[model samples]
Target: MADETPPVDEMLYEQLAQDALRGVIRSALERAALPAGIPGAHHFYVTFKTRAPGVSVPPDIMAKYPDEMTVVLQHQYWDLTVEATRFSVMLKFGGMPKVLSMPYTAVTRFYDPSVQFLLQFEAPATIEEIAVEIAAMPPAEVEPLGGDDAPKVVSLDQFRKK
Candidate 1:
């Protein structure tokens, strides 16, 4: 058997670009902490992996979610706190202000329909892998900058390896 396929890995660039965009999620959350309020209808469409490490969604919410969940951040969210490593916020779930604390690593998507700005990220491959990695990593390992080891920069060499 002869293999005629020339190994091409163009999609690696897309992954890198996608990760770069996901960094904006952290930036937006930082801006969100500016005062104590958001402006206009600039709400958020936040989606997360419920089973990610350090994720605390209400049990009922978790029951309904099972694996992943989407939350609308507008009109009723309060006590939004954004720190370099993680964030905590109060949002009404069925009229009860249940606090949900999330690490950025748990967030899979961040979208602001108001301006059409969107960013999406993923946890390498699988759920169990993500959870294990998150639990094993120290706070200093993912702090967005020097505290975290910076990001894993994708190299073009990957495409040239063949």
Candidate 2:
């Protein structure tokens, strides 16, 4: 028999690293959830998979944003609660209020324009399970957070290995 090297799976290492990075998001959100709120020019723009396993949102919003959605935690958000595996917050959309619950595993990006900090994650396989043409959807516009400066939006695609 021809000698062939068995394929080594690196999934465990990748999972561990992703979990550790998610902890960073959790820690920052926990700090922001404090009475003082996000301090000293810090804010977050979180992008998550709308249909992820543990995600919950209003049916209409889910329908409007079938594949993915981004949320801002700058000034108008309320009831920000962070837990070990997930977070829930109240936000307004078109003069209507909505609560969103998201697990860390659902998050694909976390960014803070104030410090130009950004983190991007690999989209969970479930994203592929849904057959929506995500790229065809129009981008959601978010109001600027007290500045004329626009945050750089990084596409996770650049980091993916072909």
Candidate 3:
């Protein structure tokens, strides 16, 4: 008897679907960049690979969260700029201010708690690969935060397939 399983996917449909979803993130950021900023009661928790390509953050932050980090865009954020492939913003960590620039490809998850919106992306590089890559890069500027306030983060480990 012949096997019933379908052939492998040559069209890369999964990748295409991920790309389309990333467009949604890009669009939301664009809207958030508007003068009015994100509409009433809507905020985001964006999680990304700390060492992914095109990601820039303070050395202390990268050192603290060598694998991944989640940032909240809420009451205290500045210079929220979105470009075609990446976005940059100023956010406070503890009491210190830092700027982060990240490409959409680096994002693993995006969630808006107020509206219960969530999106998860396929990481282009594995954690081991990211570690190796980060080792090769020069250290970024460091800033120390003195306060106890930390952004709330939601992990996707439970949602990932084992």
Candidate 4:
């Protein structure tokens, strides 16, 4: 007897899964946005495509991390606003504060070290549909990070396929 299984239709399950996972990231950030702040020791390390559409970072910093950058949200991050398609936050690098705005489609990895949870997704082939306006925010003082607590930004190339 022949197998009765039918070929899967082009339902775009992969894109669906990616969207759902990004939703998780959004939800977590939403919780972190509460007045109490990222409850307890919980924090996030978000890795995203620096050159991806709708991503806005300082010019020099963009030149430094032209490919991808990982930011730690443990402390000294402010004005975290989570929107339907993207999120923006202010983080300090070298004692200079900068606001980064990126669409969820630009995020390649989201990890919570405290819980050892991880989510990796393929960035969209094209992000022309994601229109985001980069708003300038007044520079605010952010506490300097200590040596041990500073963001450990390493190349995420190893995690990517050649």
Q: Pick the candidate with the highest lDDT.
A: 2
Clash pairs, model 3 backbone: none
Inter-residue clash pairs, candidate 1: none
The digit string of per-residue lDDT tens for model 1 on 1-162 reads: 987998677778865675566667667766665675567768788888887777888898889887887888766777778876678888887788888887777778888999897777764233576456557755543356666466765443422212
Per-residue error at 134 for model 2, in Å? 21
User: Per-residue lDDT for 34-139 in model 2, tens only?
Assistant: 9999999999999999988789999999999999999999878899999999999999989899999989989999999999999999876455454354565467
lDDT of 4 by residue, 1-162 (tens): 988988875886766787898999999999988788898889999999888877898998889998889999987899999999999999998998899999998899999999899999776433322322112323444546774555545443333322
Backbone N/Cα/C clashes per model: 0, 0, 0, 0
User: lDDT, candidate 4, residue 110?
Assistant: 96
Alpha-carbon shift of residue 126 in model 2 (angstroms) = 3.0
User: For each candidate, what is the lDDT?
Assistant: 0.72, 0.86, 0.85, 0.81
